[model samples]
Target: MTRVIVAAGGGGDAVAAVMVGAALYGAGEPAVILTYAWDRLLVDPVPGPRGPGDFTGLRPLTPHVLAVPAAAEPVAPAGSTLPRLAAELPHTFALIDPHHGARGIARQVGELVDQLAPESVDLLDVGGDILARGDEPTLKSPLGDALTLAACCRVDAPVRLLVAGPGLDGEIPADVLRDRLGAPVATLAPEHVEALGAVLDWHPSEATAMLAATARGVRGLCEVRGAGLAVPLTDEGPTVHEAGLEEALERNELARAVLDTTGLAEAERHSREICGFSEIDGERRRAARLGARAPAGLDPDAALARLDRFQADARARGITHTTFRRIAEVLGLNGTLRLDLRDLLLARRPEQYEAPLWRVPAEV
Candidate 1:
């Protein structure tokens, strides 16, 4: 029988869940992965989370919850990697609609359990941001994870919250999470990273990329996001920390604030009131500025020259590594060009590049 693994965050968490599932259960175990189709603002310009109406050809699992088939595609102006993931990865990907808030999510989970009858359920978060106190300066997105936490509390099955690659999301620092985590349950090996295969070639999740890199013995300070948070990577980067769902909820103030919320706005309002931050507001503002335009093409020589300068500056700043997203931003390329930039940079300096991140070569 299949196990239920909830992708606590979004795309990256979904990928991490596959790794966790394979480690916990044997490889190729059939699983029903409940996930949100919320791609980053760069990928999907749409301001908040997309509901059932946002996509076409979703297989209805229930009145509220929907299943995204491999053929499913997001409606116009809305883009998602879930369908592509459904096709590439070996798991049934179900869509989580947080439009109706936590209660609705609880109802959806209950319905799913009744239908699928999975052996066990796991709530996976790539980073420990799911345990954010709502006041951390680095906290970016907690609404979705909070919604999952609150809703899982109401689900009939026992849900275990597994945090893989803690603080890799660049939100919570690894040192801060050290005290919060208990004994490590598992460590991702190169084989696990290899299992992900070609998805690493184009997927834009920096944290997940770091996880794979860590498994492959990568270590250094990774500068990520527009904020340029310097995340320290160590050998512990691949270790998975298992924490109680109750304890995690206890640590997260935002999750408690949105437990009774019925609408997405209600939850967002709670977030603003409790955490003093609105992720949707940030997304809306960025969407207005960035629009949906694709990244502009650049001359090969000029691009490499610019990258050479960017690398020198980063090295001077003690930044040993960075993600494609950061490189795209540095080159003034829109988010759409992240993969193209990766391919270009890799083709030029294959030895200095990892799958989804680049390592700055020592001054030579």
Candidate 2:
């Protein structure tokens, strides 16, 4: 039977869901993962999640649900990483349309559960943002996760909440998450990281990259992408914890607030009313301000100098680990240049980098 995993938040959560399934079901089994096509600002630049209409060649699983196969591609001006990820990951990638909000998501998931007949239904969030209380000072992107949690609560099947790399997203602190996460159901090993293969090479998810690095035995403080948030990496980083769904609903003020929402705007309104901000709004502003375009290929010496200055400041702040995405951003590179930065950096100073997050290299 196929393993059904719901990738709770978009971006790296999709990759994390696949890793979670591979750790539990093995890489050979065909798994169907339901996820939003939402991506980082640099990846989509359009802000918010892409729906079924955003892409071409989507096969219908249910009238309300669609499958994102390897052949599927996003129409121009609305970029996506899912289509490329579908081609790379072995599991079947399914799209979650949030335009209609939680009610629509629940209906879509319920129909998918009936069709899959899987051994278990899992809602996997890379970090423990699924359990956000909605008022945490660090919470930036809680609307999507809250909506997913609210929708999963309405699904007919028993959906398990699998939180991997707790606090790695820098949404909620690890100490705050420890009591909330309870005990872990599974600990991802190096083999599970291996299961992801070369996906880490190009994926821009700082949290999921931390998940792979933590599983491979890296530890300590990681300065994540966005706002220089330093998250403490612990032994529990690679473990996937099964949290109480009902209790999660109770803790998530925004999830409960949006449980009955019928539109994305409605849910976002609730998020702003509760948390005082919309993440997509921020993305829109950033995209407008940057109007990002591909720059000339990296000048190794100049890029190395940039890293040296940034790393010195970050090191002063006690951050030892970081992702290539953050490094590229510091160098004023866009989403497309992140991998190029990674490739160039690793080729020059392989000792400074690890699979996901890397330790700052000694100054060039």
Candidate 3:
């Protein structure tokens, strides 16, 4: 029977999903890993869902079914998290194009389901925010998870929704998640922690926070500041919990509202209707404006000057930290090059620059 594992949150979730899959299905179980090209602006310079045109070459597995070639390199310079997964996992990794929105994406997923005829499909979310009712004050980037969840509901395969490291993403608090989750069937032990740690550096933030909290032996009411401010966390044994996909949709008001969305724009509109505001969308607009005016080639001296002004503006707006990725986006630096520049700027942090947002105030 064919089985598939999909990351509810892109980027690091893809890495975390594999860890969960291995634990449940045994190592090297030959499951297709499905993720998206999008990532948080904090993690990638080019934020937001990328279009099919952005990909250099995508082999069509079936009609309306596009899969990333084993060695496909992104057409754009924005560092994509998908390629990393593709490189590490080789032929097993595929990316979903969310540009088509909820209904379009669900159709693609249906095509995949039809081809594989999978006996079961598991949608794995690193954080428990997928369970949020959309009114949570801390909720940001709910569109991706909501869109994926809506699409999952359309699949004929029996689907299982599992959330790991509850509240680690700093969106939904652990206590909140616990109140909703009856109990977890599996807990993240030291071995699982070790396996996760091996690849934790690849995708930082939430994944790193969970690993650190587990290592410190901190549980219940822990705090993580990666996503924003001092977000609460719960040790709760770093467990992975399972829930019926249908029941999960029923509980999430926003998910249910957008389940029938035909496109990305419609999904986004419904998201704003339910959640009130979208920080990810706002940042995307700013990044797009920045990219539009950005020079084709970067001048470090000029770029740093712009960043200095940006820091001042952020401070004026009471923004604590600004990620190097955001700076790269504003400066219009391309993929690997932006990462390279970040390393150099980080090496010169404190002495040359100062910002509360820099993870390491004193060191890179």
Candidate 4:
């Protein structure tokens, strides 16, 4: 099922939203819909009509699905522009705003939940400092109250409470969030700050790249262990030492191809040294003696069958298994190779087979 992620904040929350969205997308999830509550802005048409009109002018950002709400007057005169903007952007996933008062914001969220019931929603409270330290008394603090109400709202999906920056202070504790809201409360990692900044700055590409880099970092940690393969220097030609079996196989292939080629001034000499064969004068002599002998006038199908037998014999003798496993491990396919090998071995002699050695944990 597609989950809806609601991000609430000002310019600062934008980057975090984008980064999260990009990360989710990279993980093969649906694109995140970004919504911002215009909590403190006066729009042009109205003195303070708090709804979704304040952000309508930003319609050009349809590709990113950014929504802005209109302004709420008198009580939230500065933010009236926000609601208006939000009203215009229907494509956004969810609307979020810090509560000036607990009950009112809770009631609003409850109403929104009822309206958007069955659709999963995650609420991210962005720009908390503004609500906590704002000037007006009417702009009291509604974050704590709103969170409480949102937690109690009846829905199949639990409400996600995301607090950004210093705003994390007043929200429910991690334990309480799990127990009461039936949701996990997580802090934005410090590393995500730059990604958040990129989103707010409207640099989607940069934000996406940063998220990708983070994924790669996490994947590297999960895959690599110890001081991995090391390079070496040698007088012969700086040959790579401690190279994995895969590298050795690649080098062997190159050497084989060079020895098999026809025209070369020093072909006979190099071939003798490289292939460990007796001396030969010309290309014809070498082809007749050292080169792989073709089945005399054999059909194409027969030739292919002979080649397959040779390849299978090479594998069955374990000449390629070690290198294959090492390469598979490097490419994150060790588990798959183990499974296939176990299946093959078991099919041959079920009574003698045992469980696979490379058993990745179920959780992983």
- In model 1, where do residues sit more than 4 Å from their true spots? 292-295
What lDDT tens digits, residue by residue, belong to model 1 across residues 1-364?
Answer: 9899898888888888877777778667888889988887767878887888888989987777788989998998898888888889888889888988899888888888888787988888987898778899878888899999999987888888888998898888878888888889999878777667688888878889898888788899998877577887888899998877888889899898888878999999999998887788988888877765654886778889998998888888898888888888888786557767777878888998765578988882
Residue pairs that clash (backbone atoms under 3 angstroms), model 2: none
Top candidate, metric lDDT: 2
Q: CA lDDT of 331 in candidate 4?
A: 29
Which sequence of candidate numbers ranks them by TM-score, best first? 1, 2, 3, 4
lDDT tens digits, residue span 1-364, model 2: 7778888898689899877887877867778888989886767878888988899999898888899888898887788888888888887888999999999999988988887788888999988988888898888889889999999999888999889988888888778888988788889989988877788888788889899888999887888667777877788889999899999999999999999988999998998899999888888888777775445567888998889999999888878788887888788787677777888888888988777777975452
TM-score of 4: 0.30
TM-score of each: 0.96, 0.96, 0.74, 0.30
Best of the two (2, 4) by TM-score = 2
- Candidate 3 TM-score to native: 0.74
lDDT of 3 at 200: 44
Error of 2 at 9 (Å): 0.8
Off by over 4 Å in 2: 292-297, 362-364
Q: How accurate is candidate 4 locally (lDDT)?
A: 0.30
lDDT of each: 0.84, 0.85, 0.65, 0.30
